[model samples]
Target: MSLTKDGPTPPPATARRGFLDVRDLVVHFFTDDGVVNAVDGLSFSVEPGRTLGIVGESGSGKSVTSLSIMGLNRGRGTKISGEIWLEGQELISASTEEIRALRGSKMAMIFQDPLSAMHPFFSIGAQISEAYRVHNDVSKKAARVRTIELLDRVGIPSPNTRVDDYPHQFSGGMRQRAMIAMALSCDPRLLIADEPTTALDVTVQAQILDLLRDLQKEFNSAIVLITHDLGVIAEATDEVLVMYAGRGVEYGPVKELFAAPEHPYTWGLLQSMTRLDRKDQDRLRPVLGSPPSLIHVPSGCPFHPRCPYDAQAAPASREIRPNLIETTPGHQVACHLEPAERQRIFREEVSPGL
Candidate 1:
């Protein structure tokens, strides 16, 4: 269950690569203000039995990307384009019926807030039973038995009794576990967990992460873990995708990215994390400046306005957007800084501080 120190490449491009492949995905919201480009040409792949963490500040399109992949943006004033290939099947152009058929059976999502995601009126057991029945043609009694089994498997105490409790009856951690149970009821090949550990105590968060890793190993499911927590990524994910202004600014293996992040935005995030290893440090640093507006992102790189090196950055950094170019065999970044400058800063300055 240990994550790799080196960034592992998805199966080669010549190969089909993975169970889920997202290519040049663009998602735009037509608000009265203007077109808010929530996700602009983002792309990534998730192999079965591996976890990919998508980290970013609020409104960086991390949630939007997951929603787009889940097809949850369809009726939410969002226009989605680009390819979403799941297990050799093209999902973007698939019919609504097709997507619906696949959603709970082949793919499922564990939303951030379990209280909101679950139905207050129904018992947790009833909800889980319904989910199981949707993709399966089992009798109601059989579905209820399956639900109880799932509750027990996810470590819910007194599964036979607690399964009958409502969402409000469970603690935050328990509710989150219930959601995971419901998501796994169908035995999906892909599972997208959006901030699964948010609002939980650190101890509970660690437990939840361990549970997910164990379940991933059992099911061999490709996981898309969306969160702003670096600790969670460091603990569980095989790969990291750092998003800024609706685009991926840095992507690579979690260990490699942490050891030598190439983007300034990534440097900011590392500096911002509260380090339990550095008890001698007096205070934690935070990324300077607010996140950019999606409606009117910066002219060039969206991070230029807050970048410490902006004044001295190359002229094109202020005029043109940077492409996500690979720096190593598996690591890649989208930044205007020259490779030499990025290396110098990470080695001489940023690495020591973090």
Candidate 2:
């Protein structure tokens, strides 16, 4: 199936604008060194049958946001706030037992590394069956049949026999597919995939993305796809949320953001991507400098230290943090640059190089 932004007509909507809504979410880890603000005042929403891609460099709090949404960050030393509304149910205030019951039924997660996520000792069928049995009351024989069907649906060959194989027996791609199957076992309404294509070859990555698109279409599930790969975002997501230093710096429809990104950090990210369409033989340009430490994040705009255009905003960019402001109907950006100036820069300077 084509992974285009356009897809089948969605099911009728309710009064709510988002099937999954996250508002001003904050997640901090109180380490011995200091409090690490992993996710700070981040907000976004996803409607059913639409995929929202969260992209950022490492340490930008992409995974932390997903984990927080899944209620997997509950423990000592971690502090979380803000609202996570799934189908109008508030997840942050929900009890641990409530969240546990909701997982794999109302929502599910596909972890970055399936090899580590899955238990090595358990057979694939046993694991999937157990997950199914948790949210569903079914006989072992019935659960096993459902497990085999899921394995088959995910394109594992000879599901009847392969279901008995251990996680160690599967290839990286196969393992990832199995993880997807497990996440979809209960036909959840929301799915979070964290770096699902990591460590896979290009062919396998494409296949996985295609499979995700097909499955999303089939299930009409709201998806949060967290990854650093811009190509994947462009290919599979209806919207994109660009994170920087634990906050969203830019967000909009995927195509529009790619066409005219408003933030300097976003320009840097696009420049860093290896473009197959460009005619020049120039070397790939990377976004200069490493990400900032979350424990002691830079004052004001967290990205100002490395922003090439920070001089445009001068001390203001250094003295004050910018909140996301609408630059267009749906596009929002957190930058001090004037909207007109941003467009001029992208058109005259950044676009040619990109």
Candidate 3:
């Protein structure tokens, strides 16, 4: 019993450091039409053992942000600027080989679609072992053994046999689990899950979320969960960042953000979700107007075009850009509307409806 007394202790709740920091992240693609701003001046951070959810509609730069962090945007006629510091290491400045080494060992991503992300031609064991071998100087037999352990850790039944099966041999949920196992194989400190629950059945979705939660506690990994599902964001994240066009419109604690969202774009996202909490609520009413084209994004606030509060907003929303300003401690919103007015609208109109 005395031997257990000296176990490592997690920092006090107030004494956490930013384990992953991304500042002014800008990712642009050169296209026939023009340069498309996939991510525009985005900045956020996640601490070890915490989850930060990046939520938005399709093309809101959620996946692009994750890809940029992983350096998957390299050599694609893409221009990426900004500093992605993972555990104080400047990733943007790191050499290609340096980043490649860190890809699985320090940072890993669970992609949205494992079917497409995994190699169908190879067996799961080979793929997993190859990933392990890339960062470890282990024999193939040792790698295969480690791969089976990972499969077992991620809850695969009869993992020894499943390890030899191809990607197509695994079901949708199994594939998703395998993806998680691969991401965890190297015990990465940072895990980026881009729509980890996409295209799964409702039950399987819940299972995946639970799996991530359990694994996160075990590994104490900093996670950036990218998803359009607000429900998943609410249940999974410690903080939330709402992206519009390509920029962050709202960022704050999940509870406070969900209860008192300041940005109009965030309001639309919340109002549109089909909440089982309110059975009598009518059918879902999605945000009006499609997301603006990134190449032709509106001047000033990118959300101003579809913004219901545009008429009520100040000149900034119409003619000048609004910077991300902190209205409350750790709560930031980039909107031209005055903080008091935004609060009043959410409190009087938005909060009551949903």
Q: What tens-digit string does per-residue lDDT give for candidate 1 at 12-98?
A: 456553568887788999999999999887878889999999999999999989887777778767789877889888887888888
lDDT by candidate, in order shown:
0.88, 0.89, 0.87
- After superposition on all C-alphas, the RMSD of every candidate to the true structure, in Å, is 3.7, 5.3, 6.8
TM-score of each: 0.94, 0.95, 0.93
Worst 10 residues of 1 by lDDT: 1-10
Query: For model 3, which pairs clash?
Result: none
Task: Provide the lowest-lDDT 10-residue window in model 2.
Answer: 1-10
- Candidate 1 global TM-score: 0.94
- State the lDDT of candidate 2 residue by residue for 1-354, as single tens digits: 111111123223343546798777889999999999999888788989999999999999999999998899999999998778898898999999999999999899998888999999999889999999999999999999999999999999999999999999999999999999999999999999999998788899999999999999999999999999999999999999999989899989999999999999989888888877876776677889999999989988999999999899878899888888778888889898999999999999998898
> Which regions in candidate 1 have their CA more than 4 angstroms from the true location?
1-17, 279-282
Q: Is candidate 1 or candidate 3 better by lDDT?
A: 1
Best by lDDT: 2
